[model samples]
Target: MKYLLKGAGLALLLGTTAAYANDGLMAEIAKPEQWAIPTGDYANTRYSTLDQINRDNVKDLRVAWTFSTGVLRGHEGSPLVIGDIMYVHTPFPNNVMALDLNNDGKILWRYEPQQDPNVIAVMCCDTVNRGLSYADGMIILPQADTTVVALDAQTGEVKWSTKIGDPAIGETLTMATMPVKDKVMVGISGGEYGVRGRVTALNLADGSEAWKAYSTGPDDEMLVDPENTMVLGKPIGADSSLNSWEGDQWKIGGGSIWGWFSYDPDLNLMYYGTGNPSTWNPSQRPGDNKWSMTIMARDVDTGMAKWFYQMTPHDEWDYDGVNENILTNQEIDGVERKLLTHFDRNGLAYTMDRETGELLVAEKFDPAVNWTTGVDMDPNSETYGRPAVVAEYSTAQNGEDENTTGICPAALGTKDMQPAAYSPKTNTFYVPTNHVCMDYEPFRVAYTAGQPYVGATLSMYPAPDSHGGMGNFIAWDNVEGKIKWSLPEQFSVWSGALATAGDIVFYGTLEGYLKAIDADSGEELYKFKTPSGIIGNVMTYQHGGKQYIGILSGVGGWAGIGLAAGLTNPNEGLGAVGGYASLSDYTELGGQLTVFELPGEPAAN
Candidate 1:
């Protein structure tokens, strides 16, 4: 079952300890002057240590520079700053631009890949590329056509290009590539198209296959040691996935990995969550649909699963578990634990022991979540760690063609792919959330390659009987499983959040305003309108002794699909268009990066 790389020099490459490469990357991340990775650091904290613009002076922040990607689609991830250069990416065609920071943001080189336009049809949501990765003088770009290309950082010359998946059969790549010690990891998209999802690792030197792990399949194909890989501290045994499905239906079972990934060098394990199962109709695929909506921890060297925990089994609401996993250390009940905190789309915030995969705390982060009463935490109960389903909101219980109404948080959940930020300064997590509800009807459908296999029709709107707002920005205390403060918004905060040592937190709205708030109190400090609505992540870096805050404004994620793709139907975008139809009234289509800084002279290096 060992999947070793094929090339001759791969032995030497694999011989290099992960600690050596991790140490080099860790040193780069230690420097506050550069954003070396997409999620700020491997923990996916999205936090910065810069304090050049403090809360007292943040009101005077102004635009220092702006650059357009010229694609005019949804931008989901932030740019990477390495030394004196910044790497920017675009959607669809997947263009990469390297800007010279020593100059006035002049473009040093650009790499554009020619992809088939038909690939756009298979994409479930808007055509968005999360971002890029840099390692060993190479810039890694995962294209929408399922190609992973490695470019020379300086000249933008193609070093190697590898095809990971086939777009003709409903496979694409949207998540940002992760390059570890000796491999570049990429995940496949298209859960709505009944695509069997997987994660593949390629040799960093020559792009040879290192190992591939499927989400649902035989234990050997999944790289899971049935008796060794623990789930909730219990072994899963054998055929855990095959036994859960009805016959060959598991072949197209969708458990996509199109989300954020985090790694712990000490454990040498990488963590990520899987998406929902295919054919949204719950009755179509019986049993628990094992491993579909689960959080997985795997060894980076061999693609072997160490542990897993299913957050929402046999999902009926399309609530994807593919959100980011934030790794941190905290004390709970007088015990210090290596914790992994995840705010799942199922409307629950989970805190677990990262080493042994033990569930610790599970609580509702949003007040409007009503699909389930809460997660069962009783250790002695047979339903331990499972959600207590409220039959009134169960689409499956209502049966096919019956509209199950008033489901809170909708299918988009409280939060989509837009990530949250953790600030050690306040010991809190700053989350951007959606306040919405939906009515869903499930039906039976036949599966077809490259065509959507979704069998659900839904309509979404703002949550009723509350603030009337569609979104909220809250400060969550994971240790206490409570929200300290919440700020309501007229629209969903579709952008990724950034926490700084300056006691400031930043997030963008679907109305194009990038607002800065007090990290501890959730008080608004400053706000500025960009060219378009923002669905991108916020980033910060220092160059020439000047700190700058940057965000991409394009407005085409699942939250802004009504305007991004010009869909006018209420059932489109999986009910997101109907929920956020008002987004077009505030902003239009555009793609640009707006960077901010305090008005002052640069300090000496």
Candidate 2:
């Protein structure tokens, strides 16, 4: 049953009781029939309720339709299905096309932006757009050249366009925007270029700046109330973020917010995680590097930091804490608790209380993770939840000219930008993971405006004592703190995971195969080869009483950055930074939307 709200009830449900400009328009996003947000819902679960073509019959699924995205460096986002029209976004020039689903997926209209071609060189990874957010009859797009545009949902007309970041300074916008009430929230990416990261809110009525919060800055700029902001049952002291850094380095300190956002309507709060510090050389800026590698909760309307917990204090290996924080209800100690589960790039999966920043369960999802022994979560312990570094693998501790060998789970961390999906039916997190390690050597580098300021040299390969495969797809049981089932892959599982009510989980591999597996047991049910590797998220929608699954296939993200940068191993240990050496040999890059459905015509509604 789809939840449809109207009038005051709709407004109340959205927590927009204070009356914003577009209260009614915002409530339409929660309807089950539409994929309003990039992560499928405000909680960023990526789980769909549609189940007409599930488990038992999923094996009968076949390709229903296919469309090509002309310009593709990396198609890293899923198509947005609203009513009978599906929205698709491509990379580089960032094209938006609407296809009428009821009429054989015909192109209704397409909008292409006049973006500056020079911006492509500044992008840290491949040129990719994370998709769009729909609200107030507009498809909100965050272009690669640091511009945000709102297009008419029906006619594809440009309603408003505003500049959010300056590409000349190495600040680019790649992540999707999150719109709530009258605000369309967007964040910046440029940690690799010494660009200070922040999340800005733009008015939906007109593309005007509403408020901005820097991830690493003074309390006022960060919108942090030192007396009120809580971190581990303690108030954050004055200049906590500032005092953590040395000198004025905090100005260029990198805490990029390039991941997914999740909101809690009842609490009227929004949640997001920040990326790594300015440069990979942690010795440059010391002291926990407050707010750099942290998960922060803030007021949706004003963007004030309520509580923040640093996941990787003084991060050394580029292990960004920018993974998705999935909101859901979980039973802990026989009590139903509102929980947030995050499978971090640091190789630790955390389950915490969403209402208050409290750690509940912290466990390692990957057995090959050797950077940290464990996360010490006892509040009374001096190292509460901090990663106990293995001295040999600590690049920061080793300093310049020193090389650290056999760093398991590599600099890519256990995961990358690819998201994991949660199933309420089974209470399991289907995680796509990278199982590789790297040898690192940190060297000092001078910062220039539009150039890479990274201070590390890295080469990745398969971890020791492991089957030479690069990745794994596993079902994680957060409550029990164990792996329910595991599936190994030859290449990194770079695509997002999708779980359905029909007990079917879907994900794509770097090998260009779209796969459907049993939700209860990790057994492969169906597989279809696509034109290219799959780097996009998987989503399901229903049209004309028939359920269909859609995903974008065009691999060229960080894992495939080797291909995009025209890099090949000149020597045995050089070339790509991460353990993505197998990407070129295993897969090639192209763009296409592959939609699947069970055989048979649509049933009458």
Candidate 3:
């Protein structure tokens, strides 16, 4: 049942009692009738328990209501449904609207921030805000200009606003704020602008600076306890990050954490991955570029590293390690283990022991991936936990100015910022993936402040000799490290996915089709084309005793950048244009929310 708070109870829930607030938010998250957090819950599962619109009836779903954000660009995140109110956010200027579900989606209030337009120039991809976070009766927004603001959920009044990064130096914010305990955590963007990346925590109560941790730098600055922080279950001695880079290159290292965040409350650890290092021309700065392409498990309260796992050391494919980590528990080898499953940009699906940072399963989610032979799984091998790089596709080994062709997954990886969903009922993950490959050539480049520092040029196309399509939506069995079933799409599945207890999985496509499929069979159940292409995540919630599904339809992200930004060059948009150029022929630019539900009277709760 939906838990509606009001008056003194609502006040108590939003009070300064951190424990009570956490408990209250956790309670709300458990309801399944509300989208309290962007990732649905702290685990970032994106799974809903509400099954009112099951596979048997999902075909009858129709549009119940729609709201336009009045802004055009790539919409990367989903709206949050808290109780009777729906909070919607937009890109670039980052306007937020609060809608009352009881009154035909009436606007309760709107909060629009005036951000500098120049900030868009420094953003690597399209200017996309990943949506908002709600906590302690406040809606948290991480603006593109690096300012984080908290607004009153009821009145839409600014509670507190603070600038965390300097846009003049190429630091910006594109991720949604993750509120855990009494802290609101946010990460920086601009990996393509030679900006050093970091994640910062702000006081949830007052927006005051709490703690900051750099992704690449000295151990002290990174808040890494060399003696205590374990990597592959072994202590990483002092200067682990410093010794991995040449000279002071780590200062401009690009380990941006612009993706999603997941937390394990019991372990008190927040999990997130870092992006690739600066200067895609890998030969410029050597060593493993420690921590740049690593998965980090840090104490949520102190922002100190507890464990680390580097996925792609010295990344040469621009394969960012910043994909969302889905935290789940699965039976592996007759033992119930806490598993962290990630569909990495490098075309590998990883299932690791979330508690100890132990590698459990690593396999290619896409057959087209050929950059690595496979991850060395032997514990005794020197390359244990590392990908056995294929010399034929290693851009670094080919050196600068030489094109590395037929690299599967491209710089966009198998998946970009689009998030995958986990269904506990099926023990399967529904992933939105790209089936594209690239020809990458690295070249020397000089970094100028707030200017693009990308040192590589790439052109992408569909994975040859395959489906000839650009994307796939697949059901993955993490326990087996394999795809249970796969569904091909004409373009990359750039939108996030949602799995429901109803045995239905939903994801959007670059052609604006919001599709529902059978969770077990991967059979397409229903599809509705929205006003524009969908790069936004799919979300669900129940209101007035009725279940509803929602998605933001816009056409600008890395994949849709060619159309969204009016760029016609095939090489533009960081090689995304070449692969997704046809997207414009299918859908145009739009910024609106299309909500779907069954046509009938309110169902009994």
Q: What is the C-alpha lDDT of each candidate?
A: 0.88, 0.84, 0.89
The ten-residue window of minimal lDDT in model 3 covers 2-11
lDDT of 2: 0.84
lDDT for model 1, please.
0.88
Residues 16-105, model 3: lDDT tens digits: 333533765776677778998998888888988889999999999999989999999899899998889999999989999999999988
Q: Model 3: clashing residue pairs?
A: 74-556
In model 1, the Cα lDDT at residue 346 comes to: 87
Superposed Cα deviation of residue 14, candidate 2 (Å): 7.5
Error of 3 at 499 (Å): 0.5
How do the candidates rank by lDDT, highest first? Answer: 3, 1, 2
Model 2 stretches astray by more than 4 angstroms: 1-27, 569-578, 603-605
Candidate closest to the true structure, highest lDDT: 3
Give per-residue CA lDDT, model 2, range 1-605, as digits (tens).
11111111011223343254246444555556667678887778888777787889999999989999887568897989888999999988999999998788899999989888999888888898899989889999999998999999999999999998889989998999988878888999989888898999999989899999999889999999999999977899899988989998888888998988888777778889999898888878878888898999999889988889898899888988889988886655556666788998989998777888888777889899998998886788888868898988899899987888888777787998799998878878899999888888888888888888788888887767887788899998777667999899888899999998889999999878999999999999999989888889998887777888999999788887776566665212222434676677767888899989899986565
Scored against the true structure, residue 28 in model 1 reaches a CA lDDT of 67
Q: What is the lDDT of residue 393 in candidate 2?
A: 86
Clashes of each: 0, 1, 1
